[model samples]
Target: MDEVSYPSADVLKLTYVNVNPTNINGIERSGTLYSLIGDELKIANAVPGTRVFVYTVDGTLLTSSTTDTQGCSTLPIAGMSGSVYVVKTSSVTFKIRKL
Candidate 1:
């Protein structure tokens, strides 16, 4: 007797999805890019001198910082762990949670 292996049911149903397709001009586009490392929030690829604001989920303003000439800023988010926050920049707004 011979034994054959087959893909699992879940694997068989897996389909490729282009969540972020290329732009009309065939150039890939990106939105606001940032990252949270430790207790600091780092914003990159933004416009220079842009203001970045951090607020509590309840709309309470926590702190704000301005990007430098390189379009990057790092804001301290100490003491705000385990909670959701709202970060807003000149052109974009997003949510983040500190772990």
Candidate 2:
């Protein structure tokens, strides 16, 4: 079966949604946005120096890191099989599907 996808940038943009935007100090920031790039999870629009944590379904810690100045970070998900994991940031906590 063929998979249907967004045919253009405009169509993609129209469907694109930003998650919760967080405000720190006095600045508003787009919170913890992520995209699957091959086996790497690319997170964007986070606060600079925000900490990111990946944990197993049972609450076991997997890995953790901090975002850069541009408010982005990537975590390699290649070593493990796909599963629902909890991703935590300085301002938010959410579930992430690794594929």
Candidate 3:
């Protein structure tokens, strides 16, 4: 691919997604993600070359882009707030709001 990629912005209108909690089965799953409302992006594990989609809180997919190896992204969410968003990729799968 002869495509050029840009760097991600420092500030972002961050939001979070509540993972469906469980007890007996535990909350561990592969390829799990915490996406933003109205957005199609997974908060963490957003590696470069990964195909992702951005959206709004109203369930509208706003944009599409890929991530960088640093787990940084090359796209921006329009009309976003300056909040901390996080995603857990350890034994427990959850989205932690990091500000």
Each model's lDDT comes to 0.84, 0.78, 0.46
The sequence of per-residue lDDT tens digits that candidate 1 reaches over residues 1-99 is 899566686355555586546444442335446999998999888888999999998999999999899889999998999889999876777789998
Give the clashing pairs for model 1. none
Candidate with maximal lDDT = 1
Error of 2 at 2 (Å): 45
Name the candidate that leads on TM-score: 1
lDDT of 3 by residue, 1-99 (tens): 799454558545555576555535555454434455443344456444555554443445555555567554534443555543333222342332322
The C-alpha stretches of model 1 lying farther than 4 A from their native spots are 1-32
Error of 1 at 79 (Å): 0.7
Better of 1 and 2 by TM-score: 1
